[model samples]
Target: MFQYVFGIPFTLLKFLLLWFWGTLKRLIPYALRWKKSIANEIVLITGGGSGIGRQTALYFARAGATLVLWDVNPDGNAETARLVRDCGMKAYTYTCDVTKREEVYRVAQRVKEEVGTVFILVNNAGIVSGKQFLHLTDEEIIKTMDVNTMAHFWTLRAFLPDMVRSNQGHVVTISSLLGESAVGGLSDYCTSKFAVRGLHDAILREMSVLDSQVKCTVVCPFGVSTGMFDGVKLRHEFLLPFMAPEYVGRKIVQAVLTDTEVLYLPPYVQLLVIAKTILPTSAQLVLEDIIKLNEATKTFTGRRQDTPKKEN
Candidate 1:
């Protein structure tokens, strides 16, 4: 009756309901004390130099975990290591371009030699060019796929066997909400994220089949406030809030410790997934338009190209 009286489509009402449900989710309390599970775990995080990876490392450091950080940037990796050590935890950094299988293998050997054995693996390294499909160069597209999709496979292959043998480990894959809902400008980025989602799901299925104690968590978050995509415009804050890297990091750490299988962050990003089930094709298009998501890349230039404009 409200929908009819307000002349709003049923789909909008459903979207609103889901949004409200997501907003209220935090009010529903947890059943158990989960924080105690994390102490003294050996955690290896890829892309641990910055953004969510860097933030998660700090969380684990504070929680008393031995840290192994891998990233292409030696400077960034070193900074993260310094910060973790400042937290009074054991931390190590290595320059590893996760896109290459051999690099991951080499790093795995070192991590095993130094840290003993990795008890948790966080595949969080990702790159985004933010170009439209037409403007995306071949190199850019390949780089996106290599870092976002193939890296997950290589990192997991390098670490999973040890996890399986030990029968206690956690694999956390940080995929984006864009994986489920693909937008226009970010074709390559979205494709890679979507593929990683499938990879994570397959891993979960394998774990379930073997009845393994190795837990897996696939994180699907919306736009993150990290300067990775510095120039990209965000249309809405609350409905699709820019997730803080720290918030995502804390969530991932909690999931790894507590044995959660999949974690959709901010708790509300899952509502976008549910939207696909209930919204009509045309209505979905309208919703996307309202969000201004597909065209978000129009203003994006990334960190390298984002030169500040000077007043005349």
Candidate 2:
């Protein structure tokens, strides 16, 4: 079907190049296969009782990691531990609020004593309050910042020293696509997410400067199907669809095993982020409308238990 004999060689070369590239990409994952099994790898996961954290805990347990699970909810924390044990792996549960530095430090100490020094730390605990900027009170703003942004620092400070000393560990951070783009009525949520992106960048830079062997990964997913954002609407499931918790969980395990630095769920979210950075502000606003992203959370109530309680 080529135009003529002149095009024949070019077409053949292109085909050969494509085949080579495809083969190389396919081999990348295999090349990354771990020499040692994940069995007995000490992994600490926050908010492991529900949503993506819960799924990640199960995945890691099946892969043979002894888990240290933390959550504010005792019931959820215990449930995650039970699920891990059901997978034929050891698990320890702790009831600690990640936002409290002392609590996080104490738990880290206990985990070190009980499960050995954590080889992997998954900063997966997060809370969102979907209220308009004007509707947010001072306490609500502080709470959102503390839980969503500050907790990462607390956990990192508590665990990273040991990781640095061991020179063999991984840190997994769970941010959101909303970190790159904001929507109406989620100002506080967006602020918190953006802060996490900055926090992750800073951490990576510091690690690189120190030439630390502690690998880090940041996961930025679009809306997920977890009930954390259940009341939200998804106008287009094809472009920016809600991600399944299980899929997110599996990918995270793969990242930890391979030491990937960053992961974007659904892939298209990366394109959206690129567009946000390249397009003009006016064009981005129009594109945002076309994607119906700003409106997706019109009904979003966020997590049920963590909703900001109105005070007198």
Candidate 3:
């Protein structure tokens, strides 16, 4: 009993010291602009046909990584591959709907046989209905969940085993700020993002238990100009400006190279997450009203039907 009691203070002190050391380690790399090279890495990106996915593929191509793009739209996927080829890097495209589990497995096997094992996997494909709870059709809700949430599970299951065995890989999850703090007019979308965020955290924990070197990053950014949230608007643009797709893509590549665990674009979004956790329910509602978070998506038109879906 005496040893346990006396050890408490020592334990707390050790914890604080370790926390400081970890913070210092993170800062040193940022200060030095240090990033690991991904040259010759095999990168597989879902929804790589458009928006952030396409932009990220371009960035990786510039870094000498071979890209394998999977998307439901053949035209957009082909265009992305063409762009990568223009960069003088190898690029392969496959038309596969991520929402289908069997299709994902089949395509994943083909990628293994044809392109080689993926060293980095970006689960960037997503869709948003931008509909209110009652207004959302059952099909729309299911589709949102399938594309944004279940698709992660399918891809991870198909690829993570090889990564674990090799002890080398990176997994990137493109979530949303709405996943951290919910608002109105996008119940289905918010639900999907939140689910993915949770899944990402769980994967991190499991990876730690397995003592794996495979890194995981989950990104939560505000509305980006990716066409997925085309008409969405924020009341205070100065407080939280809409991010450009290129900027987001660049940041995501940086995070993966640096092995950043969790990234919040604009950075201040992390403060909002803290506020959501600490504030009272009424206070939170008032803050949301001021920011017009609930009304921001009222004007959301999303992607046009004729165009390929914007996968971020």
Q: Give per-residue CA lDDT, model 2, range 107-218, as digits (tens).
A: 8888888778988889888876677788889988899888888999999999899988887788898988888888877898889989998998888888889898888889
Worst 10 residues of 1 by lDDT: 303-312
Model 3 regions more than 4 Å off: 1-14, 25-31
Candidate 2 wrong stretches, greater than 4 Å: 1-36, 303-312
Question: Model 3 TM-score?
Answer: 0.93
TM-score of 2: 0.86
The sequence of per-residue lDDT tens digits that candidate 3 reaches over residues 1-312 is 223345576667777888997677656755476689999999999999888899999999988899999998898899999999999999999999999999999999999999899989999999888878989999999999999999999999999999999999999999999898888998998999999999999998999999999999999998788888778787777888888888888888888888888889877789999998899989999988887988987897878877644555
> How many steric overlaps are in each model, in order?
0, 0, 0
Q: What's the residue-level lDDT of 119 in candidate 1?
A: 81
Comparing candidate 2 with candidate 3, which one achieves the higher TM-score?
3
**Higher-lDDT candidate of 2 and 3:** 3
**Cα-based RMSD of the predictions, in order?**
9.4, 7.8, 2.6
lDDT for model 2 comes to 0.81
Spell out the clash pairs found in candidate 2.
none
Q: At residue 262, what lDDT does model 2 achieve?
A: 70
TM-score for all models, in order of appearance: 0.86, 0.86, 0.93
